[model samples]
Target: MHGFCMLNCFLSRPDEVTFTAQFDRPGNIGRVHIGKAEIEGYKSKVGSVITSRDFITNSKGGPTWRLKFEICTFPLKGKVRFAFSDSTADARDFDDAIITQQETVRATPEGHENMPENLNNLAIVLLQRFKRTGNLSDIDAAISAFKQAIHLTDEDGLFMPLYLNNLGNAFLARYDRTGDTNDIMASISAYRESKCFDHTSNPFYIQTAIFCYSRPATDYDGYPDDRLVAAQYWVGLSQQHDPSQVLAAYSTAISLVSQVASLSQTIQARYRSLLKVSRLSTSAATVALGLERIDLALEWLERGRGLVWNQLNDLRTPIQVMKPSGADYPPANITEELERVSKALDRAGASRELWLAPSAGTSFTDVRALPGFEGFLKPLIHADMIDHLPASGHVVIINVHEDRCDALALRRGVHELCRISLPDFSYTKAEGLRESLKLYLHASGARTRGDWNATRGMRREGGSGGVVKNILRDLWILVVKPILNPGLCGESKSLTLPEFAISSYIPTFQTLVDRVKKPRKVEPENAGIFMISQPGTPNQSPIPKPERNAAATVNRVINIMENYTCVHFACHANQNTSDALKSGFALYDGQLDLSSIIQKQLVGAELAFLSACQTSTGDESLAEEAVHLAAGMLAAGYRSVVATMWSIQDQYGPKVAEGFYASLIDSESEGLNADGASRALHYAIQNLRKSLGDSESSLVSWVPYVHFGV
Candidate 1:
């Protein structure tokens, strides 16, 4: 064929033959000829039909000359020859060739061996053409062809899965064009069926599965559970030697995590959901870094980490304080609607009504449409997070993945991030360290207050001590040192100002300045600690107990907490691995769990000093979330928190507490500045390190002490 042409023929006897030919060039005449003789590289006399009429324009705005012809003396049960000629000299379109082949094969008798394969090829070409032409008919025809091919394919055949995958893609394309839910459902069913076959031996099959799973996984409007399952499937398929697919899988999984652990769910429900996809952000960042996309790595880390904490923070943000450009105050109706919705959500969460919060949260859409509220309750972007960084010091976030480890530092006065690579540290090493520490604590009789034995001194000895020493040393050398090195971080600067030199002024001005700068001793009444009695002890309550119930005790504690600027808990803490919301500090009457602490929402709370065991240690299953007592305090409105990572020595806890408080409350300061809480904890830990020999052996006491927030 000189120009694009497709032919189909059916023959019953030697004397009768019929076929059709299609031409694509305008005003191009074509002829179809057939011969009954069996000829190979030889000429034969044949009957011919000519098409000399004007061309008809097809739906795609191209001239088409379709003609049917009958030939005499076409032999049956023998070789038959056909030829086509056109007036134009243009090359045939590849798509037209595929169509021609498909038509020829389909015209054969029923039960043709290669019918399914040819149909699949034809459908794929049609889908491609539809993509280029934006023609609904082409896609509809492609879907029909794919379904027919799949129906004809044998269930156990090698190409069945391939045909089903093609069908799924066609449905997805149709869904994008038509917005039909049935098409999406059909697509998911097709993809799921495609995965039934064993694809382990062939990388191509596995990649095809990955490609199929990615459609539903990244669809934002799809069902959340289905998307999660698809993303999990993508993750499983992408694990074998495809770094790009791994990154893409994790990126989708991480995005879906927020939907799974949605704010509409209760805190406990959110944590339970988050446990399923822990460490996704870390793994994603590792893959992105491997591909040299540092920006995406950081974005993924920020978006996925501390999801629950970020949600609570967003909820607590004051709506009235958000001033849109040219607006003096937010509209009263919007504020009222938000308050109503917030109360309903709170009630639903409190009652554990799973179905109510989603309805309540829907009202927020109207509020979000208001000026200055477009991003209300949405996940924060990296730029917004950078704007919230402190004016001094760097917030260092370290991520540990199986493939690699690194620290991303968001420093003051710099928009770009500082990335510090930690080649020696790894996920396996970190897990080993955690396991070793757990075993050491269990062996040393320090898991809880009841487990500790005073007679067995808390000193490092032999192999267990060696393990603890190695753990701390490895953390410093492999993780901390690399990020804190001078070449990477430069020199650290003091955030506070120093006292002025008296000699820089004249005698008269010096005396006036001294009076102005004189430090006034803070009265005890202005700032004080609110401490509760140790659990199981018969000490009097700081405030009167209304009743002996858990609710009464919590209310009493809340009342006392409201009057104070800071609170200190120096008791045992229990970490419930199965349900982190139940993890809490042991109180005199009952346990003060994280659920209670967050629900109270204490106001004017500045600092929380949790000198209890394992206050900052989160559940290993939910590592990415800050589901611990310290984080609970922060979510409950505390600006700063001082927590221990593990169990502390019975005597050392008091020493660290005393040193921390001594530095925190300056003799001349007017109030307890929570801004200095981090510095205070650092000073306390350094003193403890020096007092206990300042070596790897003494790390158990000092390394556990940690500070969160400014």
Candidate 2:
């Protein structure tokens, strides 16, 4: 019924903090003092009595709370270092140069080749030493070591990923060393590349380590409250992963143990008794102290799971059938502990969504600073009206929804679009849409859980559509309008409809526009004409496939333009937006589509960077999202497009679109074809990207900027 209690001795609060001893350890170093800083290790083996952490060098996890605490407080003082055994570079490798074998597919690598997993473990030990001795040189050395690891450039795929992952650890160490955004992003990218290489399709396991490694430190740079939040986040995140491996990592990397100074039997016994008494009298003995060592806590909890499983009234037999694998994972003492670990891991594994949900240590600054932060949000688009933009001086349109909503699964979101609409008290981004959706769902006989979390998994049958609507409503009101231009929100019927870009792809006018009349050696003017998406380096020795396409297209189009500068981009479009739909105007061999069919691949553009919808949409709105298409011509040197807000129907696209190009050309000078077209097209797309709040912006199909050049 109750949990096994341990004497938790940690710096919970300054001045009033209490310290107690659990027992004496191997090679007792000295007499116990209440407050002097100490260095020790925690050991699972009995009678070893923890001494130095290096006892287990091959394994790089457990705890270093005391050391981390010191680093967090005076971050400028600590540093980290690393040494790699292998490194490489290979062009055939679609994987970043990182590799690691993991326990599951969801947490494993997705590509054939891998980049090194970034890390810097040795530097961590030195950092702890710096904390104790205040050695500036140590910090500098750690920084240098990590940077060297990051810039490791050998074009051959010959290095080991373990070392690469450790290089990532350097970023973790630096972030702890300094609460700088660059370090966090660098760390995130290193890990992401790791996923691209390894065979596992999942990216969660690496994310877990990154999260813990970057956890805010207590009294970090002199912020005690921040330290508390950091610790809480760590515990929450550590517990969120599966028990088999995640727990071990939490134990190895996060917890720090101090030696009890091996004592005689009488002294050791007395120490234990004293610690127990202190637990009752001091606040430091509360759960939070032990909470930091969640791995150990989880170990204890697993024991408790036995009884807890039986206690569950609606438990299934299959779940109970899952037994501990051999002696390596024996049953634990408490049933509830098992329940806790199991629940946390299940939730973590089940929810693949990278959320905007409140994490204990999360902030906008940290999130935005993460590498590819902007790219991450591209996947969540819902409705886009940028292409067929309707113009209203000011408007507020609301669709109450055909049915009521489930009050239990979601919350209302509200935000003022920066330049789009006037500030209305009741109108909000996600909140208003959520409200209408809930009402509609309720009318339609939807159910609810006590409290709600908007994960896609926890929705009713008709829930997703309504949810998407609200999300679109929110996306328009909050993110899109503010991003495109908030001024539009002031005069228009502020309501925006939904469009799922999942149906297609679209190309740019450049695909339709004429190319140079002839082809020749590289010229400076051609720079803006096409950009190559070489991996590793911006300008590599080999031109990419996209660039090759650009060359071929420019050659053909230029010949046509020389005779008659009039043409239309003939291609397919889909229902997806941004990268999903593959945007930017491009031209690919028509036979390429046939190849996709033969190969059984998702046939499309080389870089569907920013797409709104596919040309494949149904001829009419009767099927709603039923008919959608994709469009784009493939070209060499180009990767994708950074496009408009969201989905846009086909009919309205060319109309509002025409206005964009006209405005663009008006801004350019005569005789400057390259400059004029580039600038003009960008202007047109950006203009169309804005929602004027007219009937045009609400077509509810695909939308995105098309990129097609050299």
* Winning candidate number (lDDT): 1
Off by over 4 Å in 2: 1-524, 527-647, 669-693, 696-710
Every candidate's lDDT: 0.60, 0.29
lDDT of 1 by residue, 1-710 (tens): 32112211211131232222453332222222221111111122222212112112222232222211001111110112222111121123434434454554445446765567666766776786676667898899889889988888889988999998899999999898899999999999999999987447777776777888999898765556568889988887787656568877887887888777775556665776676677777777887777777777877876776777666544545342343322434666656555555544433254344334444465567667777678766655566656666555566677788888888877656888777889998889999988988888777665554323354655456655477767756776677667664564344332111111000111111111122232233344645667654644334212222123232255576668767768887666777765555777766666777766655555456778987777888777877676677776766666668887776666677778888889888534467646567777777777886678644447666677777645
TM-score of each: 0.62, 0.23
Worst 10 residues of 1 by lDDT: 498-507
> Compared with the true structure, what per-residue lDDT tens digits does model 2 show for residues 1-710?
00101111211222332223432221111111101111111111111212222232113233453333222211111110011111112221101111111111123123312212222333444444444445566555555544443455343344435445554665666676677788788778777766555654356765655465445442233122233335434544445544333443333322211112111112122122223222111111112123343223322222111111111111111123223333223233222333343333222112221111112113222423444333221111111112111121221221111121111010112122112222332323335664654454344322221112221122343544545444555666544454333454554535442221111122321221112211223232322222222212212122212213333242353343222112233222233221111222333322122112111221121222222223322222112111122222222211222233333333344554466346534654432222233344455544554653222123222233333332
Q: How many backbone clashes does candidate 2 have?
A: 172
lDDT at position 72, candidate 2: 25
Alpha-carbon lDDT of model 1: 0.60
